[model samples]
Target chain A: MNTTVHEYRTGWKRALIETKISLTTPGDLMGFVMPTAIAIVVLLFMQGAEFEGAPVSLGAMNMPSLIGMNIVFGGITAMVGALAMDRTTGTLLRAKSMPGGMTGYLVGHLVSTAMFIAVTVIALLAVGLPLFDGLEFGTPDRWLMFLAVLVTGIVAALPIGAVLGALLDNPRNMGLVVFPIMGLVAVSGIFYPITALPGWLQAVGQVFPVYWMGLGMRHALLPDAAAAVEVGGSWRTATMFAVLALWAVASMALAPRLLRRMSRRESGSAVAARRADMQRDW
Target chain B: MGHPRPHDGPAIAVADLRMRYGDKDVLTGLDLEIEPGGVTALLGPNGAGKTTTIEILEGFRGRSGGRVSVLGVDPAHGDERWRARLGVVLQEWRDNGKWKVRDIVAHFAEYYKPYTDPWNADDLLDLVGLTAQGGQRVRTLSGGQRRRLDVALGIIGRPALLFLDEPTTGFDPHARREFHELIHRLTDLDGTTILLTTHDLDEAEKLAERILILAGGRIIADGSPDQLARAASTTAEVKWIQDGRLQIHATEDATDFVRKLLATDDGAVTDLEVHRASLEDAYLELVAQFEAGEAAAAVDTFQEATR
Candidate 1:
């Protein structure tokens, strides 16, 4: 008998590429891209509108709002949704059993989520450039600020996404997560200005990372005049980066422990029973 | 049977393995030994703890209590090297369903070191009779074809020990035959040790060198197919013709009886025949015995309590 020796060799790039290509599924394209597209177009029309007291051209606001939406709905939400679906389907357990599997697979997912967020950002930019006529996209330092916000937002949101995925164990529970976060998005100046809200509501909005991410992007995209009226000045941009970074660090630290705990509860029979039950019911 | 000396032998040795789910125990002090080479069929009905034992051996599930050694290492603490030595085809996989056939196969290739270059995933496609659909999405493939893909992925790593969980459950007759041939080729050519579980008795009879039947989380019987078929306690059903009319008999020694009957009757025996017992009959008989034993034990306990 040769009794061959075996070793686990994982190609990170290949894994990442495979993960990216899988994002073309219909549910993902429809659920993620459609809403962002609608938000952008609506903001474009709203930019040209004259409100009751003032003429508010929200066209410029579209970029920041879309960016904010991308962080919550696109980056974080999709990451959590994907992992949750994998757990529900037994894919995560199956992968974890393979050699060098979990690390390779998760690295792939992170890359894929980052790539998707980048693509969504580019698509939103392309749509924004053509839709609003008075919009003059500049070589403003705003791009740096937007990139900073996006990176921090995605990194921070990933741990929370992973924790939710680990804790929820199913996609429907993830839906519960989506509604509340969407509620946060609605109140957090993504659709309209949070500044227009009452004091208590504005305080509630500030507590969420989504609001800070949007505020940071707005400082980068909107002209100094509009940004000053909303968030004081460039000083708030640093604060946004620091706070979001802290959340990211905290969530990342907590994710693995939560994942391990959840894994402890998983058994082949129980999973099999759950799947059988799901098939019978659904 | 004499116990074989433990001389750094056997690819897998499991003893006193026990597992529980809530109040019900799935595996109750079960034991198993798998030697290297050929296939060992893990046979059991639903909820029989066949999956539990296999999962624990594969390091995918934790056993509540037991000592298990696979390839000289305890599976509970086995590392990536241990996992790489084995290939597992699970009951279901849905992650790569969205990927194209070629991409999915090629991508999995990177997960193993010293893996042979994908030798005609198309040729394999042809072997599994999936050539016409090689480029199609896996999700679009029929259940049998997808199962063939699962087999393909399992063997892609060229594992030393391959774990197959009902590999042909959804397969039609033709696909099942093809899959059997594929399995035979793997063992013959590469000398891969395969541990498989199946509800299909025919599959066990055709493929396995040794078979283990599990019931109520215990190994009720384990031997070669013929040895199990002729297990001392199990009866052999026999049938033969005595005159122009047909005659049927059930006995432990059909061959001996047939010879004696032929000698006494001279040329009276028209259709001298003896039907060979099958694994299915032996299996059903064993399960029945186990169930009856449990019932009797329960009644005995009741009687003792009343007295």
Candidate 2:
């Protein structure tokens, strides 16, 4: 096999091993489970309430939005967190030492991140489907649309995560990303409809992937009449796909260049310096 | 598993190498050459630019100005094929903490498969004396064990040239000894040139065939262990008891002095002892002089004395 091809094959193996480790390790497993459990609890509480002027329960309305929000969280935060931690710990330098090792390291993370997002989405839906009513999972079209939204959502968010991961020097500064993401979540209407928010806030939310991703999920799982609460009283499936595809294209263009620059700056001294900083902080 | 190189020049050659970290010169016109198949130690005090020099040669860092060739390729533009022929053991590695020793080794070994046959993970583990700990998490390993694992990864590709940066900084005596033995084993392999940096003079004496003492941005001393000791103008101290009186004398020739004293004493000399200057003593003096801002005088003095 060609060298790059072989490296990518090894990357897939790395992904498999990492996924197995994450699934088997208690702490890692809990990271996936805890959020799902909390979301399910929230859904149960909202099951009794109904959205104003909408036919579905509030729980049904929030379920798909939560799934969309989880996709963005899993794709973006997981990528950024993994890259920053690996760079801090000298894993990036280790990869730089070997032939074609950087390729393997990156491909491995992409695979693992995709798997993580998929597993989280599946787990959330599996637990939420039986406990909630008015969820539109009974038909093949719903499942297919759900799969499309899931894949497209990850593709849109992951490269941006990679760019953020590459730009940040200190893992401790990861909190810098969290606040903005939470703000985006609040404006993007993960818990409620953006239609009820200020017009400018709705416009601002529309400009980001988080809102569009939530909109895509809502289109897939919510009943057709539920579109009454969305902008223009329509699903706007074409607009959602176009905006997400644009984000994916723009991020994919920028991520590799930024990632390459970051990898070039990796060395043993850089790692040692970061380690020293971490020690001082602690 | 050795791959024939396209060229047969020295394993490493550097000339007029310079490294400046924002106007402060860490290495000023540093030069070195290493032949194949033996261990060479770059001995220096901390902040002597040892790590900078090694990292430049490893292609991990770009230099300010220099000419450096490792395995007949300039590291700045070295391709993956060029990289596959070299092994680098970093000073400290805290990566893959969640990985098992065997698994991590196996994963690294896979990267070398396209270039050459790599050491079997199990065999490499045994070679590094980590066979019993292969199943354990890497973060749980002791410091010494982790260093040994680092060595295992460095040699997994059967690299023609290996670079170790301070291989045993925090090792206890027994672990240091074992690490030294492992290095010796690596040198026994066919045509593997090893360059290691350390601040420990005793380690340099024990493991290296040639020693280069780097100080103040240059190599102040270069020779074998005994030659380095002799190159420094450090005399041995001779102690003896003659006619119920203690006598102590410092002399350049302890053997001749002891012989003459014994001949004159006529069985009266007692409690005679000779203490020659060890390599550690020579290193401490050279570093002290360099740090005291007499770097040029220290180098000239050593070179003059040795010549």
Candidate 3:
């Protein structure tokens, strides 16, 4: 890599570590940790449910898909919130002017988001496996299924989060955008299977990526159980990954352009004009 | 005024520097050279392009037209090496308010190439009289304290050239005096060249060896404070008590008249006071003249356009 890229990546890693440790307030701590915990608790609680082809219990339900939705709410939503604040406060502009600026900034945000999600998922899993008596993963295939789902879900969620962050300049607006998507992911098959929803609602949920992502996860985590349901098909995993890969690639490509445009709007005179008005009012 | 001292080189030089916004000109064919290791005060009111000029020099804004050089490099293309030599304290700022004072300073230090050690950051806090509160969160500090921290951070890297934009806008009289001493010490002890922009005339008079007055996006006057005072109106006010009554004389030859009065045993010449001119007075007079000239030019342009 070039010197700029290397330096930015290094800076980004440091920024991430700093952000994770800087959490002080009770509200902030909960904001990061609660969603992951809730997802795990709800997943384990709904273990013995009836599906179209089989009577599923905690021992046979998909664990990886539940974890994916947890990452979406806890990791991606938090990333958007933090970046929106950075943009509003002029910290991002300062980062642009400094050496290895944008590379470092984006890297820092991504690393922090990933780290938090990993920690939250692990913590929830540790508590979940013991509390949910019926849930078990003794086989190697089940473990491989969980890994594939985890990797695919995180990759899919990241670009959507970045796109939301880049477009919404205000944290309030970002919250408005995030909560609805998060709600859709949560209520869809991410926690409980979409088959539980009303017909029209299930149709609506199917249009979203979360439904496909959850379906893909079920195939990986509980392949035999998933096979019994008509929803499991060769096309489901292939199609979900294809569409998600497109989103991830497109969003990553578009993020820098969006960020550059925003930075240009935040050029020196723009800041000066704002300060001049503040001075006048003062 | 001190004699122009011999210099190793000009610290800053701008040749035919031009910057435009849309069709309007912010800086028009501007040219300037500042000597190394002294405070050069840029004096101008709002909308005079003072901020624009400083931002361009600091490498924050790109120039539309001109060859501008600062610390021997064009700011537009200056690399990390050049940035290492520059310390800029802009009017706008963003501190993670949650971070402690010392933490903020330490973080900025990492961005510089060859900054002073940890002690220098501590010493700066003491220098700015914020040593006791070094551990306090920045959000807890007052506006003046935060501004002082801004200065301390600006100088922490021991930059060869420092740009301060209205550094003492909200400082009280005592704090302003102390900040002036801090700025003086930066040059005297470290040989750091400083270019400061300010609306406060008293600050410019107290801090700068050379002051440049800008009006309507162009420099109207440039000289030492005393020279600007003299170059303003040549008229002087001659006041004296004559026959127990106050008498005032406005004349160009006030000195000669005062000498003549002294030559005689004129007890009536009691309370003799001759007021020549001052920097504030000179600045006001120059602004008035510039406005009149602009008004006349506008009328001529309007008539020509009509024809």
Candidate 4:
């Protein structure tokens, strides 16, 4: 097999094309913009509320938290949904038909998703830096730290999404993933500090990547003294990266086996049958 | 990049292919072979294992026991290099609905670039007669247009062999005719071999140089459409009024039978009718007899009629 770099280049090109189309399309543009718009509106509303005797307004704190949440939370749900939808629509089978198409598809999806997350986060920052008090990014260290957290958070989320996608055969059952994440968000403390929750709720939040992602973002962009209100009374940056790293490693290990199993079962007739079932479900 | 494809063997070769799902056998020791570069249609009623057989050939499904090869490599072990030499078009395709027609062609064209010289997107669109809809999103295309696009995508890589599974199942006559013309045009593309499966006997007769009728998990009939249609039965039944009484007889030649009947009746015969057994009637009757029981008898019946 004389597989070449051209296949990956093609995949990257697919991502670029797909991203451009989504940005231009009305329905897809809403998905990209609506969440960030809502986040900005919420930040404007909470600009005055102080959080647990911290110098930062609740809105300033919530900005980084929302960005973090979007990475880990939105990444998983969106990937799971995209995979299930693609299976029913025969896109997966179409990919399998080509020589290096599967690799191109996956590389395209991951890069495009990262591009979308970056765009949403940038939109949040564009509004956050000027409108909110107590948010910091002037120094080189802060910028590097923010970029690191964002990259680590994305690495932690993409494989988990791929695994969930392989497990859930029906997109309708996406509520299985959504409902649990909704419950997790309440405890992960996107709108406030996790230290304010019950000790047990704080521990539950810490167990998943969602809470750690929030903490990493806070460590990156929030004032260092703001960590006084956190669970350990400081930015536990090492533990946060360590935990997210473990999540990434574990999921990356499992994702390939499951995704391979899923791809093996894909065929033209199989896709047609699954699509027929999906229509009946509708 | 300079590797030359080996093209000396039959395009497809299969031996004793078997597929078993739990206790049920879908394919029982089936065998087949096709020399490269001609259209062959696989005709079978439902549940005759046509899908199973085709899927196995496409390397999309595994078989219980068999040796199968396409393009000189065993399909079970066919690699990307092997895959690049074949094309597949299925029954339905609504994927990539968000992409423009030309963009989809362009994107997939990229996938084949590392392996071979694929068709240019515009030229392929023109070949499939979809140049007018190149700018439109795929979801807006009508059903026939969509199938044409599927064909365009399938053969974009300039594959040596193309598998078309029931290409015109729900097509209206005009649409089917245009699709058939497009299929005919495809034959000029440097010895591209096509294997299509359908239940439409007329379509099989129209498009295929050879037809294989798969029934009872094996191909019982294989020949040109003319031969298969002629094999079913060769006699016509004649009915007439003779001396105010109805007379009926069966003969191989309807004209000769009618001539004899009228002459023997001495100018009293009237209201004559000749009912030759139709190709469709033979096919449907064969299916009906197979459904009635005695799997062995179905083939026996056709053979006896032919004899």
Best by lDDT: 2
Itemize residue pairs with steric clashes in candidate 1.
A47-A57, A47-A58, A47-A59, A156-A248
Cα lDDT of model 3 by residue, A183-279, tens digit: 7875566655666677788878766667666666556545454545534434266676776677667777887787766655554556555445545
Question: All models: lDDT?
Answer: 0.69, 0.87, 0.67, 0.85
Please give each candidate's TM-score.
0.86, 0.94, 0.79, 0.94
Clashing pairs in 4: none
Deviation in angstroms for B79 in model 1? Answer: 1.0
Of the two candidates 2 and 3, the one with more favorable DockQ, higher being better, is 2
Docking class of 3: acceptable
Q: Kindly list the per-residue Cα lDDT of model 3 for residues B72-142, writing each as its tens digit.
A: 78888877556656677766566366667877666655555332232356777887788888888887887
What's the distance in Å from true for residue A148, model 1?
1.4
Q: How close is candidate 3 to the true structure, as a TM-score?
A: 0.79
Question: What ordering of candidates by DockQ runs from best to worst?
Answer: 2, 4, 1, 3
lDDT of 1 by residue, A170-236 (tens): 6656668888888888778776777678888888988878888787766666666565346443437
Cand. 1 Cα-lDDT: 0.69
Give fnat for candidates 1, 2 and onward, in order: 0.45, 0.67, 0.19, 0.66
lDDT of 1 by residue, B1-307 (tens): 1111222577889999999979888888899999878999998765577788888888877888989998778987876656666778877666556778877676666555443333346565665566777778888987777877877777666666788888887678987887788788777745578999986667888999998877767776688877766553234555656656788787667768777877888687775566665556545554454456563343233222222
**Tens-digit lDDT track for model 4 on A50-103?**
877687888888988988888998789878988898888888878888888888
In DockQ terms, which candidate is top? 2
